[model samples]
Target: MKKILLLSACLSIIPGTTLAQNTTAGTIELDMPGHFQRQSVSFDYVRRDVMIPMRDGVKLHTVILVPKDARNAPILMTRTPYNADHMTSFASSGDMSSVLEGYDNMTDVIADGGYIRVVQDVRGKYRSEGRYVMNRPFRGPLNGTQVDHATDTWDTIEWLVHNTPESNGKVGIIGISYDGFTALTALFHPHPALKVSVPMNPMVDGWIGDDWFHNGAFREENLPYIYDQDATPKNDEKWWSNHYDAYDLYLNAVSAGALGKSRGMEQIGFFRQITAHLAYDSWWQNQAMDKLLVKEGLTVPTLLVHSLWDQEDSYGAVATWYALENVPTSARNLSIVIGPWNHGGERVEASKLGDIKFRADTGYYFRKKILEPFLAHYLKDSTISLPARVSEFRTGENIWETASKLPAPDCASECKALHLEPGHGLGFTIPGVDAGAAQYTSDPDHPVPYVPRPVLTKGVTGSPWKYWLVTDQRDVASRPDVLTFTSEILTKPLTIEGEPLVHLTASTTGTDGDFVVKLIDVFPDQVSAQPEMGGYQLMVSADILRGRYRKSFEHPEAIPANTPQLYKIALPFTNHTFLPGHKIMVQIQSSWFPLYDRNPQSYVDNIFFAPKAAYKPATISVDIRNSWIDLHTK
Candidate 1:
């Protein structure tokens, strides 16, 4: 009875969200009922695990879902190392079964609207046969640097189309995060059966710069947490033990002062071992998929989805979009959707925000309108058409806006440069209007707490901006090492589209330093905040650039104390229309504690090996003459 009420409530709620565009050329709207009851829809499915043969003779574990009534249905395939069994559990839940039971493991809201779903474990994880290698090659011996997971994906698609009954020889792939990477790899081969794909937050590049690593700086906090949760262990005992280890590590790491000292020392030890290889050496470069995708080319239509606030794999989505856009294939299609939500927050936030109510129907519109038409047209050859572009949901406005392309930079006037004068706070000098220089001390022993706690290590976690929305940095602004800069509130709405580059001319007293730059939208009012609802400010976008590998990711050089250097760091690109009332704020600080590992002031061979005594405060200077962030304005 409770399940029935839940279904009824889901249907009764009207989606107030707006669409990106009002008119899509050939779009066909299906008469979807207001609410779908789980009991009303029924389908027979069989879950059988089979070994999918790869080129290297190692078979990957795969699970297939077939509708009992269908004799011939096109296959919807997904390759994921995050366990197909988890997907099965997700499907077994109430409304999800309506979509999951009929299709392959891929989640299609149109299940009542037909398709076979196929899900396979990647080469090394889960029930897959091969020994799991973390983002390693899918074929050849473990030693080869040239192999990739794409080949393994290509092989799986070929086998599924041939082996699965009622498969119309047409296949579409979809998945989020790493699973998205697998879907994208399958497209590199462009098998005849591969017709469509949706790679959401796919890992297009492997070097720490893209997803796992950021600017060669180990996202130490997120790394251990994700590794502890997602990476498959050598066996069941190991997996279960590691799960407990993760909890122990989390408790120790977050216990105020016991950060570097804890029970899960082995987990932190493992983190140090992996992060020590920071260069874009063989280990990191081999996993990047963009270059390989371009070289092989994609033969299928694709849709790319990412969250503007995506904490885990932000770089992959935008990078892959640009990479695939240049491929010389007519059938190649690229569409992107980004929203102001965390990695997994989009699906769950439908109704209330804390006690405040901003009614939202999370996935219903996407499932019924966008996803349904896309799959129907590609897999079933349905007459449903689609818009050229679609972006739905914005937080403040609580509505959707449609645009042909993402907002463009507001670069109408000459590019202006603001200097970070040693003692002057961040702002354009009004002749003699010297706002006393901003300062804050970044102590490795006592660093600024990164909001929304990073995954596990001591580094910036997923979206610290969310937490910064409420916490005023004004207190930190008075410190000796933190730098705060702000641009005068725009007289007009400033629309910035594309990437922003930060050019800095500075010198550090230490051998290594981290420059964390955040682009924020300062709200009009301040409010008391909570863990979930950090008040007032809305973080549009933020990014961190490691100083050591500024010139080249593969090598690092010590900064001679007091010697000036030129460093140009690429801050994360953002698509936002900064309203006239909002102020643009950029915060530069050397240490974002526990969110990022502390950099010892001394020039050390490896951070992991640096002795605890080496950690100390270092004085740094920023010359604003050559330091400024170039914002692309429309």
Candidate 2:
């Protein structure tokens, strides 16, 4: 009888069903896929609005959805600042906006699987009471940040388990992007009911590396855009419409090869207001989840999901994962899944978004086969087995591989460093081969533009973009303003599984200079190939660091022109297993264009105020006495 009822409910939600109904709250309802019936399962659900209360005597607006028959079941929670109604309604309408939208009516799906679904608006956001605190979290009384989402989540869960009848008393949290950060925070003070967490592209660290900043260098183009879109009022579409217009203008300028010519300059004033507190002060430092993770530790199993091309939150995710894995804990279980997709590419093919062609339904396979099974096994305590170490989707090979540990190549330290000679572009040779250092002048006025790929900047829109094979630092090397370094081909596969550090003894002609290092997997042939598997790029990993922030993030000092200073910068970590017959390539450059704000050659109070006239071509000398990048290998 239960099976029959579920089947009927699912049938009512097929492509063309006249089952449209309106609720008192003006919510439009439509049936969604339900649980299995007979040979196959289906899911059907409904969406509604409800108010959630926080512990701080504040009411938060929320959107609630449940499987048509869900009662007395565990709850799968997602608290977000993004509009719940818009996300839910769009999911029901079948026009997928974000990855979370496809599962917007999660109530029905989880219920069909025997669980309840709940999505809430964080405090101070849309529909929620209490002043919205951006990334700032309230610590103690009113002494610290404005808001801490972890406490809000704890209160919300407490309210739902007690108020909402039929709850099985167990809760699992899942979210992407900012909401993903919220999901991570909930685990900080794991409720007795909280069992599992999936934080996808979570903003774990807000100050040093994130959408706002990268390697101490500010992401000039994207940061301002994000601030405008998120901070602006959304009562009407006025702010959003204007935001999109500006985005379009920026996009056009990028396409026309005129990057800084967009309306971004006009919005500089706004950017200053949003990020006025530039240094990693108390405001930004308070939001660093690494510190919080240590203070209020994790007590639940966590699945860290990320994409290699996640231009916004890639570094933060990697840093958070490493930090958590190191902390001693029995309750904390760390696992990672890295794909070749962009930020939202896991749900949709990147090619489709850019009118390119590729394999069909990459997103569906991951959701139904991988994600669903993981959630089901853990939440339901089913007899399904889970992989122990890593389950990665390799882009070049176009298949999934599981390993007890990250793959690494057999090699000695003596075979690691590759020298970048003055004339010879990039090739592997002994370290002390006397290959003179290359020089380049990074002018802030004409910063190098980020490599233009179709989907590199497609925010939240799951569009397939063209994937580049191995990154060719050739262009950067050929440019007079960039330096190229290469190592000899590895006789065997070389696996880099930990944080990469670049130790440099260098002197800059200016007060501050930027050092950008890209770890590339050089293919045997100049031309490499990418599979039609999905929108996966064939690059291994890359990172950058600012010289001023080398010694300390809080303090800044100028460098003596002729005197050498030992600057150590930690590049982003990677778990890549570089294949045999491939060479490890590293490119050292001072600029990455509008992706990061350029540093003026002059020693100024701020890079933003550095006049165009102050931008002068400066020479940078890198001493080889103790300059090298340490790669953790197997």
Candidate 3:
């Protein structure tokens, strides 16, 4: 259950409350004890709760807020699995004039743009009636009997236009994260009233990237993540772990299945369903939002907002953007904005990431300048124009740029290989061919921590994992298990403005392992005085490739022990300029604990089922002469 807080003096309960947005950047705060000590935002609106029946006859609990002095207004709707209560600011009382607070607290936006806002709980979640299936696949060519998110949204909008008082025929949908994914599904079969959708930071895929798994490796955070999402049905609390050091808990448990079993995941259907399909089988692929849109194509305009350092859903943002390329320009109207943010951090205070300052309030610019204009132009017929097709904030330079498309086609030709030189160096110019390789012994018993801290802070509302993307790396740079390759200070700035990749020519003594390749920016030594800025090693782009899935995500194959093999790990998309004095660095390691489950190193068809006894120390080697990182530098 969401920890509820009533407006009062001398008490605040915003610490552990997670919002429907689910942004890793920061938690939303409901200011208690205002000067007036009012319960909710002050807006003269009529509020009512209605049960809208879906095509399948499942009644979806919804909240409708209409302005009392309202004329014709566009209907802005959002369907969320996080429940609709958060959207409501307050509940109706004996005094009808009393205002309520809600998750869709866009009362200001509604008042300015003249919108009839509707927030709904999706089927099988919270107040909604029907079986809940997470990331439900799109059931296209719907015969009246078949149902999915697309049908549910379509049916809800159909009922809203005719039933809701003061609602103009025009409708627009918007949401972030899981709610954002639902909004993406609605575009497939948009009702006539639906005109625009802004699915910001959508969790498009669970198997490849975003939320559940990343590159075939089961996310270690999944255990606690599910606990916070639906822990109430089983009479459990948000946190499943009683231990302070969460990393040690999962590390001691060994395999993913063991962790799940220890937590009584047998009682959770989603956990069993996820563990059953370790591979990216038809079950996960069919649920991909991009694949869903391919069939029904976007018939309405979409504005995508993403964070360059989005801890959770960056992969979904980039993948979904490209997927729309298959559709015609006219039908698939899409525009995107990538800022220096973490998860939904784009909407929060985004001036700095970690200690590095971007020098401007990017989150403020996105919301006030970008999102506000998009809604106005599309829904309210405002004269304000939409932003360029792609608007990305360049990090090192601290500036924004616009292009016809992301990565700007010209970047493909500018791709250059920065070879890993001898003596822990990075350079574009190759030195004399070297034969020796860097060796590291990776022990599952003493796995490398993703952050410098020993304890893993676990909570959906306030987690240390949320800011791990921007955490400093100096602590791990000296470790024997981590390989650090740095480049000489640049005479001129090298701007990396697109996708980066790690091509490791290596092998492990064990049959199975994971390769975590990270691209970091090492600050100049003179910057070592201030603690936060002191010789900071900031990780820009990084990713992992489970060796077993190198051959195929669908077909698992073990690595041939003591043999050189090429593994291409695609890091996330970034736009950072390596400053003149800074050095480009790459760190390679076998394990990133707590962030991802530790690989057993022993060959198994499914690592989830692998036992703790199977885990052993593996000597991994990376050939300096053969290995290189492909940085898309301009």
Candidate 4:
């Protein structure tokens, strides 16, 4: 009878049924993708490309996809700064009835044959009208007439509700990366119709986290595309370098200026901006989302989604979610869904990451159970139980866990210090472990690659970059420049949840340098079940720190030569279990190659403007004092 009821409930949701199913709260759907594609169930949503006027009179390009049969359907929207030129093809050709094979990837599961879906090109990008400021700051308490992203979102939501014929007088905004920032800005100045927003891997602070920068280091991924705007119409959209080993290309640049001036890389203007502000100063503070969130407080109910292994926005994901930490869990309108994904894992099949199989179709589960349900409950008033305030996926022990708060409030969780001992051993604190210090010379010419070069073939294959965190580290583990520390075999599984941090007591021979740290799980040397997995060293969590910014990110200063400095490299969010017989290892290095621009060991006012001559080798020593990683585990 229960099985029959569940099936009937699903059938009732099929359009044209009045069997009446509860949709306003708890729902458990059969996680079956095959059942959803019977007859293909292709649905037509009227596509309209119109100009949405912001309060300031700037017209923005917006795509309105309204389901023909579903009248008064709730509107779900995504606003992106990225080019929306392909969408324009929908209305321009007047072939609206023909299915959008590409866009349908999202429409299929999300639109579910019908929901008023809207996509808009944010101001200043593509065909949108208005000057685009990357990561426009949230204007606090707009004076009715003030204009900003906050007001733009509120105004757009208002216009959408009244203009879209079938809009149910309610709107929900969603975006990834930059668009995610726009969604977050909407919460600051919400419209009456704007009920909810999901900001996935949004930019939090330019100086610290997200795509452009990590802490104070400049991220090289987007630099190729957003280069000095020299990319003319005649030039293709291949933003990354053409060299087979772009990793080595950027590494050799030494300074941002060196890279910018050569090979037409100068067209990338942001390269100079990054070198100008090495600290979290006015340029970044004005746009920092964390500061805005603290002052404005997230008033609207929000769902934050990000992967534990998100290469770009793990910092933003965890920082944005925990920023609302002071707010009571019950009263908190902020909810999160952390999965074993890299970057946009929520959109992937979810079962496997590179060579690591998650043993489940994690992506399908997120889309069917989590993503679909959350959007439906809030936007369509479907009876569904939203995910817990904190929904985290546990890797190694593949399962999703929920609780009132993340880092689970359970007694089993706490910061257990994994101390570094002499002879490269990792264990709980011993009486006098400081036996002196571990030392190495970091040569700029021989910088360590963030991942094995063979794995970085995406540049040639044109495959999207993903899952670098899960890349096996056995190749670089034996490098002379990398400091490797290992713990004894675990007798029982050691499950950890939440952010892990590595605190190092070190000093560099030069005035400026970078410290790279990796938290790894080492499989036993001999594995009977899977010999291929033998000695597989998977990187769980890792981070890097610019030695100059040891004291403050906003006020970077040269490291006093030969002086022991404390560098705390806080890693990204992670949920994993170090199974019995497995070993826990932490590896420390100086450079991460082209993934991040190498730090010139010699400190100059701005590292980017430094000449090639400034690049030099330096000896780094990490002493045993209070140097250890604080792993939060259950």
The candidate scoring highest on lDDT is 3
How many collisions between residues are there in candidate 3?
12
User: What lDDT does candidate 2 reach at residue 456?
Assistant: 43
lDDT of 4 at 492: 93
Worst 10 residues of 1 by lDDT: 237-246
Q: Provide the global lDDT of candidate 1 against the true structure.
A: 0.60
Model 1, span 147-234: residue lDDT tens:
4666776788788877887778888888877777777777665677788888876777655545556776655555434445433443
Hey, what RMSD does candidate 3 come out at?
A: 10.6
Tens-digit lDDT track of model 2 for 167-192: 66778898777877888888766677
- Clash count list over all predictions: 43, 23, 12, 13
- Cα displacement (Å) at residue 192, model 1: 1.7
User: Which residue runs of candidate 3 sit more than 4 Å off their true CA positions?
Assistant: 1-43, 90-112, 140-145, 231-237, 330-332, 408-411, 460-462, 528-531
Off by over 4 Å in 2: 1-43, 91-114, 141-147, 233-274, 349-370, 393-415, 418-430, 452-475, 487-492, 524-538, 580-582, 624-626
| Per-residue C-alpha lDDT of model 3 across residues 279-356, encoded as one tens digit per residue | 888878878888777766777988887778777786887778777864786334988888898877765667877666
Judged by whole-model lDDT over C-alpha atoms, candidate 3 comes out at 0.78
lDDT scores in order: 0.60, 0.60, 0.78, 0.74
